[model samples]
Target chain A: MKFNHRHVLSMEQFSAADIHAVLDTAENFLELNSREIKKVPTLRGRAVINFFFEPSTRTRTSFEIAGKRLSADMLNLSGSSSSVVKGESLVDTALTLRSMNPDIVVVRHSHAGAPHLMARHVGAHVINAGDGQHQHPTQGLLDLMTVRQRFGQIEGLKVAIVGDILHSRVARSDLIGFQKCGAEVWLCGPPTLLPPEFARFGARMTYNLEEALTGAHVIILLRVQAERMNSAFFPTAREYSQRYGLNSEKLKWARKDAVVMHPGPMNRGVEIDPSVADGAHSLILRQVENGVSVRAALMMMLLGGGDRPRGDA
Target chain B: MSAGVREPVQVMNRRDFGRALDRLAHEIVERNQGVENLALIGIRTGGAFLAERLQKQIGKIEGVKPLLGIIDITLYRDDFANGLSNPVMGPTEIDFSLAGKKVVLVDDVLFTGRTVRAAMDALMDHGRPTRVQLVVMCDRGHRELPIQPDYTGIVAQTTRSENVKVRMKELGEEDGVWIEPPRPRTLPVAVLPPPAKERSKRKK
Candidate 1:
């Protein structure tokens, strides 16, 4: 019943059962999330240091709030402000943080496998927030958690992940995570954005947004990589919206119960219409809210508990 | 099913269990004066079912159903460092507010009262109820915290070495109170019958 690994560095490290164990734990913690104080003394004296080598207000703040909610001693260390700004090597900065004797170090570096590299050098548990375009396990987890809460089941649901598929770590992580959860995933966007290799993870690729939207239970619109705004992904935001944007009319063809999701900081009118993003079916805010619980599940499992065996938990 | 399967010695039987809940429901209605602002919230799995049964009995008397909610105390336990390897969570549906409501909390068994402590903490976090009353099928005392149930269905005194399990038929099992003595190698549970036969069989 225990999650075998100490560090949660990759979704690749998980099986469907392991992911189920995590989602199960997160659902349990959802009660705490609903409370007024929204806190539990589960990790009272434990220290969770959020080391983000990438500038991220959203992910870092979510982890910070999750830690604080669990009554953990949380410390935030961003790359620009930390010793990394002084040219300290990744390993050096990790060892320095290790000397503080923290219980966990949640590392998010721009270089892929940076968190994995830090885990080897540090005694404390490491959770990968996001590393390069490799994997953002928690983001993927929070998204899945939101969908599961709304749909009651992830199995057999048609999840359409649209926009900038090639550059999205969220898409890659979701592809692996959702497929493992038994959902049929459809990768939708321009041909350049929707790479053929994504099919290796069991997602069907489609260039037609309308085809992906039809019969889909969940529509996940990725933030069009701002860098892609200049590249060959699409000609312009106007052209892209007319084709791939999840506008109100495009949403009409989706299942009545179908939901719109974005790993936010949305390009509102670009990838999604403001109407649909704020629409009753959108689970964007809930996805953000679930981040806390999913992160709490990860920290609790990694630090003191590794998925309770059979009973008592 | 085995032919002529004999019934094991139990603290309470199906009919007695049903009668106890009916009595508890009457006690709740009488004590609360009426179901005016009253609500029933069950701790998940065990308490939730008992709450439903209690609601049914109360409904028969009052002709009106009290608002019902659920609390899953899995994440709220104080003994996270001990046992709790694979903590399974259940649904907590409280569509109504606990604010200004007289809430009756229900559970199957009252052991160390740690679960009650967790449940109270979990419930308070949701919203402050004008009043909070506790109910349990069996009050098996071990008082780790200064907590007690208000409307007790049965007070079954158990030893520190025995487990009091309230198996319900709602889960397709039987309804009875079966006490379990400490196993040769008991898991971290304070008191639970020798791990079910198949579970302990695997250990062998």
Candidate 2:
């Protein structure tokens, strides 16, 4: 099948086959990463723009590494720029960036669906790094790649996502992505942080973290948005951690082999204790490593080149 | 009536394919002078199988195997953008370096030499080989580049209007070469020429 879309705007844009293709491609890139030179000229001389309208360290750095590894001319644009600070519209920003002739644009914006709008107006392939609380596709995919790598298969696995669901773009993307891959999903947190409508996407919702962790194959802890603490979403950080925090004792309820995952900037004492975060179950760093491979795969797929790295390049 | 179409006709069967590979192995060793510093790299899919078969033959004769690599030149092709709308990526599995070794590049057919050109380009990326030799199962005429096979099993003469296909036993049951008829052109029928019978009648 044709790689159905050019712009990777959301996890919703991916079908099961699309996910499979991404996984398969990511595997090749992982193999490539073992080489001594560890570089491919597939995107050599092509221009790439990391147009992040939101602040990020990992996603932006991972994308920069991925593009640079492919030898693409990469430029990073964060929200702190003078033009963006002067309040130029997203359309104007995208048009100005497009004028510089980027072959691909990785956009992370505060407003949701910003990448989709930029894709419609520009000629470059737009990869949504993250958009508000809507989606973070690459993170969802890297999580999937890491899980699939550990379990040998995604289908029939039970994945439990604990911590904030209402405010998490990661949670939303993962719920849809895991369901699409045939994994059962459970969302656990306080009712204020857990959306009932998330069950509409096939994830079972519960308030009790222990109930969610029971018999699960993978447990993902999302970092609590501390900014939301001021908004009365929860009574306090101590209460939230005491109720939903993943400590070693609570982790025992999960299968012994259950993978503990967190899309990080970890809150050591809040959503997860330091012992659990640093324990054997943690896939935090593997997720970061897979992050580069998965992004490389996505960029390569978007460029539509096969295994043949450019000869002259 | 024979007017409608012409089908693919098999030229060399599976047994002949084996014999050809067996002979090509001897040729490769003879040219390179006893496989010293020799390595074999196959162009993916068809050539990979051929490379392995050659390895087995070389092992049987020389009592050792040359280093083996398989290259998939999809990304290296010149028409990477315009030619393939959705290309399925395969891995380039050259684990060892080509520092100063004599490399033999293998493929099923030598047609336009584009595949070989791409393979050479891909090999240079791994590191410069001291020498590179081309080994093809079939050398069908209609060259678009100045590339000729160092060792060829069969020379199947063909025109630009025809297509040549090479199949291996590893891929399926039958192993042979087939030539396909040309596709019909899309030019308007109004630009006319008299039929032979009509020309004879006019002459009479």
Best by DockQ: 1
lDDT of 1 by residue, A73-183 (tens): 999888988888888898788778778888788988899889888887766888899999899999988888899888988999999999998888898888888988999
Runs in model 1 deviating more than 4 A are A1-5, A24-35, A149-152, A188-196, A206-217, A231-258, A273-282, A303-313, B1-8, B62-67, B186-204
CA lDDT, candidate 1, residue B187: 62
lDDT of candidates 1 onward, in order = 0.84, 0.86
Q: Which consecutive 10 residues in model 2 chain A have the weakest lDDT in total?
A: A304-313
Q: Against the hidden reference, what TM-scores do the models get?
A: 0.82, 0.88
List ranges where model 2 is wrong by over 4 Å.
A229-231, A305-313, B1-5, B35-37, B183-204
DockQ of 1: 0.29
In terms of lDDT, the best-performing candidate is 2
Clashing pairs in 1: A307-B85, A308-B84, A308-B85, A308-B86, A309-B85, A309-B86, A313-B84
lDDT of 1 at A163: 92
